[model samples]
Target: MSTTTKTNHIGRKISRIRELRGMKQETLAEVMGISQQSISHIENSETLEAEKLGKVAKALGVTKEGIENFSEENVINYFNNFNDNSFSNSQGTFNANNCTFNPLEKLMEVVEENKKLYERLLKAEQEKNIYLEKLLGK
Candidate 1:
């Protein structure tokens, strides 16, 4: 018996990224000014023209290279490693730079956890502010 592995396929890569982004063919089609059928066809083909690929990349909010190099395993590995909370060495002490913690991810988690408090603070700040509307011609 022989075993074979398929290499990267541009169309499949596009479909995967689009699906991961929670987008539907209809939505992508609308944004690209093409019919949903066209989007389906594009997703099934192995190659796409550079110009058309640019349009698809723009609609999906990613660069063309991102779509071309998309790898599900790599993405899964990234998320899995990101969820790992162990930041200590064998001595059980935190690293000086906290290499295991992603600052942007932590910031986003904090923002989400305090959404209501943030909204309230913004409202209070706005209420305490004073603004005057000047007459247009005066």
Candidate 2:
């Protein structure tokens, strides 16, 4: 497939991951440290950069390899099918309660929440530095 096709495939995969995790565009952007507008752009299949790809992979709890290798047709078909399901009373709306796999979404939350731990670590280091400085009369 062409590069355009690959990019579109990745974009649709992102949308699925977001919907699976029940994350809004704004929330995903916050987790990825990018603007929601950027997420919007990427999901719409406009264009994507390596850095944005990394951020999306991190926030979506998917590996770069997985994201890169995802099938465009499957991703797009899923979105199209999902939309169709929403309108079809027989298929109904999206729900994982009936599915077999543990949702990938939890990973997204856990990884993003690690930021809090990082902050705590930084504070502890700062406090340790202060104590050491006082000990040395600096």
Candidate maximizing lDDT: 1
TM-score of each: 0.59, 0.43
Clashes of each: 0, 0
Q: Where is the poorest 10-residue window by lDDT in model 2?
A: 82-91
Q: Rate the local accuracy (lDDT) of all candidates.
A: 0.84, 0.75
lDDT for model 1, on a 0 to 1 scale? Answer: 0.84
Ten residues in sequence with the least summed lDDT for candidate 1: 129-138
Cα misplacement distance, residue 5 of candidate 2 (Å): 9.0
- Compute the lDDT of residue 1 as modeled in candidate 2: 50
Give the runs in model 1 whose Cα sits over 4 Å from its true position: 84-138
